[model samples]
Target: MSRFELLVRGGTLVVPYVGTIRADLAVAGGRVAAIGLDIPVSDAATVLDATGKLVFPGAVDAHFHLGIYRPLSVDAAEETRSSLVGGATTVLSYFRTGQHYLNKTGPYETIFPEVLSSVAGHAWTDYGFHLAPMDTAQVREVPSLVEQSGVSSFKYYMFYKGFNLSADSRDAKAFTMSDEYDLGHLYQLMEAVAEAGRSADRRVSLSLHCEQAELMRLFIDRVRADGDPQTLKAYSDARPPLTERVAIGEATTLARATGCAVNLLHLSSGEALAAAREARAAMPGVDMRFEVTLHHLCLSYDELDGLGAKVNPPIRSHADTEALWDGILDGTIGWVASDHACCLEAEKGDELWPALPGFGGTALLYPILLSEGMHKRGLSPTRVAELVSANPARAYGLDGRKGNLLVGYDADLTIVDPDLEQEVTTDLLLSGQDHCPFEGRKVRGWPVATVLRGRIAYQNGQVVGSPTGQFVAR
Candidate 1:
């Protein structure tokens, strides 16, 4: 008799490299113990019948911002609930300390403890944080953060040189500011991070928000001077594809200069992808990774006529959408993130030009991808797993434990009814924010259930666990 804690039978288990196979999975001590047919299941504590279902590795959303500028308690609790419904089991998010979150300038020792306490006993999924080194002290303390809190990843917003994008100041609603670059400050920050990454035994890594700050300023100012709906054209025109092209070129150059592995966040245009590809090809030794969102994959400028469609790196033309799909098809693009920074509709301005940039997509993540990328585009299911699961896990060093359904990996899994199709509506959303840009869009794939570490965390639209989501170190 096998000592099994749980047995999941009748579903085809999809492992990353081996392809999909119908197998009975037995779990013990929170790891897959055996996978075969008719493994005697009477000793198991529980059994799950996965008839007519696809069992794929649960998504690891690498670029999420929960509790960013908001109070930690409210943000962490609500976002974890939102993540469970969307079938994401592991969330890797960035916490900034300058002025955006916590409102204090301090070291990781001060900030991390506060962060840990706020999120403790409140999350329904496993969590990890990437600290943004806002000051010189935080930069030097990167290795110590890794040693103390097990947080092995760090981020820098090359675009937000000084101030950051926050909610409203007086009204407490719509606040968007850009990061500035003080030459001495940014260079030292990058240098310190590279040194710390080299020394840390757990392999600390770095990520960058690559848009050029000065260019963005110039472009935004140019749009204002021109004025009106025509300014909309100027907005996309000034910060055109070339802006991303130039910025990506510079980022790759900086990564090579710093001798650090770099992950580029939110590469929306084809030009950006090509630039990353070109940089990697030119310098074979440089470690670089890039990702784009589901919104960029499906929606175009025409679809975004209202302020709701507005976002940074504004949704491009139809041709750009096609090109992004091309990148997804060819494997140049790495992972897919919701970038699920949501804002209320009231916060969005009446005009197209001044509206707040982002809208909610946490609830629509899987459905949007399934509708546009998999069902409509004819992308392989295996490829969907790679984009949503495998690559993100590998990039963030969570691969061994999070992104696969193999023996010894976490039992985090998503069961989807690929044939169950429905139109997306904001009324069904569970995020703290109430609006979505993809409202009214229909998709064919829906998550039937989400399991985190051998426990049913979400089923049929509600959370099941005790909010025992563990905070992952590195």
Candidate 2:
């Protein structure tokens, strides 16, 4: 009988918070079994020669919206294919009862199961969801949703209260069924999440999209009348840093009062970062985690390719990008993710104000981290592993199975050839979306292969097997 099912030989293994070592990794029954200078491969069912490559734990992209712009089934099949190409073995996508997702408002009892069924057999990588409670009725279902559905993390969009759209837009009720997505509702939601967390076996958290809606509404009117609303610069000006900072402060205060664990999503500017720091200082007991995205870290307003670069809490200036990098290096930022939303070219119009908010970046998750974090910023491979894998896995409650290369951890990994260089082009990407905001940018240290649970899912720029991904419960 074979001692192991698979053996990956002769690679430099990078473990987060641990230094690199050259070892052969062994896998049996879809879990890591051993690692050493030489693991006997004679009886292995499969063997991969990974000579001269950097092998790190497969990235866990903690933020994505697979079905926000496309049908759920279509988006899951295509976008997860793109995620595999970038070496992510696990994805935690955000779903809600809203206009963009399912375009319906109801109790999560029916809605969440539908969300799960839509992508059940289509994903190419293991997946889960972080849900948002949009109304009072939905808020009442949080405990059951967390307990029965195995969903540990919930979300609150701070800017969706009463005024969700622009000043001229009349579709507020279409997005949310509630008349009050206000602070009182947020406080109640936090209390419920905190209560659930107290009893749940795993860590439960609340993720917030921290931008004040009233500020956004007022500024959009000013920008349309006085400033040009069709430029990336104008988008940034309309939703300024102060709005994000103010919301962060308010949300953290409510979190403190309710004893809820908070995960602040996609902090875009220096002011936001500063406010997060202040909140942490003020309320030492509130558990808070901060997140930054690839777009925020890599692309700035100066380098945007047009309407495609526009996103919620829009990408900021070059100085803001530098500040984010500083936070990443100094351990203030908890993790990095691709808020990958596959908005197509047709939806992203020529004018920035009318274009859809998000673009696909899951295909660039690992390469961009290596190109910028390791090559340019002097970040160690271990740090890169934590930023993309370990920390996120812990944050979203997949810590035991997904994050590191350990004796019992899932055999999920990405092998990168540091010498290889590639350019970002729409043709090179696997997303169903036709355009890329990162088009024409050159990056190095690309992922050459990806391993998911002892099987090679992607190698040499191609997906190897059919969709074998499963629903990962929290």
Best of the candidates, lDDT? 2
- Least accurate stretch of 10 residues (summed lDDT) in model 1? 167-176
Q: Candidate 1 residues 193-244, lDDT tens each?
A: 6677787654556777666656766766666566534433454765677778
Tens-place lDDT per residue, model 2, 1-474, is 788888889999998878798998999889999988788779588888889999989999999997997899999999998998788999999998767888888888998889999999999899999999877888898899888998999999887775744444622232343677799889999999999999988889999999887787788778878856578888888889989998998999999999999999999998899999889888999999999999999889887758888888898999999999999989899999999999898887787666778888998888988999999999899999999999999988898899899889999998898778999998676889899988999999889989899899999888887988888999
* Cα RMSD to the true fold for all candidates: 3.2, 1.7
Residue 34 CA error for candidate 2 (Å)? 1.5
- CA lDDT of 200 in candidate 2? 88
Each model's lDDT comes to 0.73, 0.88
Taking all chains together, each candidate's TM-score versus the true structure is 0.91, 0.97
Error of 1 at 472 (Å): 0.4
> Candidate 2: lDDT over CA atoms?
0.88
Q: Which regions of candidate 1 fall more than 4 Å away from where they truly are? A: 162-180, 201-203, 230-235, 351-354
